[model samples]
Target: MNIGILSDIHIDREHPEPNRVIEGLVNVIEQRGVAIMIIAGDIANDYERTLHTLHLIEELTEIRCLFVPGNHDIWNEKHPDKTSWEIYEALKAFSGNLVNGPVALPNGWTVIGDIGWYDYSFGSSQYPIEQFDQMEIDDRVWQDKIKTDWGKSTIEMHRYFFGKLETQLSAHRSRKIILVTHVLPLSDFTVQRPNRMWRYLNAFLGSKQYGELALKYSVAYSISGHVHDRLQQQCQKTVFICNCLNYASQWIENDDPVSEIARAFKTIEI
Candidate 1:
């Protein structure tokens, strides 16, 4: 079946027109014989944007929209306590299926998806914070936080986030799984951006654990968004796609941006 995969639509600033992007995507799906649409996070960054997106979702009761939360959707700047659960609640209010782990679709295709963190190279010369070095510190903080469940708890943090990925993969064993995440497991897709933003996005959106998890499991493809620039790359045998939902960048990069990028939703048949 044909599915529309959309990501990185940062509708946080779109205000009353936030639904326009969703409607644009929906129209593309309707015309392209697409049976469903899978959004790989960053749909909206705030409550107002979420409400606007939800209002449109309420109108769209026919199509199946599967989504995983992106880092920005949960916690970007002001809202630090925002979890994936809160995002799910917001979407559920509009009858959308906010699947955290692996879930089997009505069409028999299983999906393993989550808002995964960025995977960093511990030994890379450019990397200042090594996972090995951080692990030692993380362990100490984790032990103390468990006594009181404070923000410094590494085990709790890992369990709450990365652990869900493992659980999801195990649950969907042997199935033809379409994995979705906001993080790029490998650094290939992220090499084009500025280092500081790259590091920040990587810490929150990309993870090697997620990559290894994908490789260990029966994943067909991994879709993601967070890096605003769009490109197609591969890690081992897996296809990694970063989708750009904004037309602004396309315009800046080209004189004929409309003809080049088209600012339209895409339908990738699997």
Candidate 2:
């Protein structure tokens, strides 16, 4: 079965709503006979935007759209107000299939993945953070919170994320499996944007550790998005497609003109 993958639309409340792209996307999916549409992450600029965009996405098509969250989804500066779990819950409520692990799809295919966070660096491997860019840790005390928080603590969170993946994968080993994420697993597709900060974020968001794990477990394909520039690459046997916005829109006022950006979404056979 064919699946159309997209990400980082970053639709804000301005200019073109997702309506235009959603309509075009629906037409393309129908024309291509794709069975599913996977929106990896960054479907909107924020939480409220995600709610609006998902409603638009659902209205424009009958195809199932599985979603995930990106760094921006939880990058809000407020702690008690914008915790990662809060953002996750928003996503879960908006998209019934916001996959944090493996889920069975139509036909014999199995899907797994997360709109995962950057694997924050530890020790000597860490990226330099500017003094002005201090983390937003508000009144939330780390010591007081434990199992309830997902990204507040150690690699234990990642262990849980990956652990769920391993379990779901183990249950369905024979089907064609597709992994979807918001961040690219390798450096090749990630180097497109000039922002070093975003590049660093992309590098650590989704674990390269899990990328290899998926390959080891016999995944057929892995799709991702985060950096706006479009690209494609491969790791061992798995194909990685960094399919960014199907079309650039005006909400990104400083981005390339809409016509130029829209050209990138031209269809490709799977």
Off by over 4 Å in 1: 14-19, 51-55, 76-97, 122-124, 130-159, 193-205, 234-237, 247-264
Tens-digit lDDT track of model 2 for 147-226:
13355443455566667667777787788788777766655555444353443444344567567666887777777777
Q: Considering only N, C-alpha and C atoms within 3 Å, which residue pairs clash in candidate 1?
A: 117-205, 117-206, 118-202, 118-205, 118-206, 119-206, 119-207, 183-205
Question: For candidate 2, what is the total of clashing residue pairs?
Answer: 5
List ranges where model 2 is wrong by over 4 Å: 13-18, 75-82, 120-151, 154-156, 192-205, 246-262, 266-270
| Candidate 2: residue pairs that collide | 117-205, 118-204, 118-205, 119-204, 119-205
Cα RMSD, model 2:
5.9
lDDT of 1 by residue, 169-220 (tens): 7877767778887766656666555454334334433556666776777477
TM-score for all predictions?
0.73, 0.72
Distance (Å) between predicted and true CA of 134, model 1? 12
Candidate 2: C-alpha lDDT: 0.59
Scored by lDDT, the top model is 2
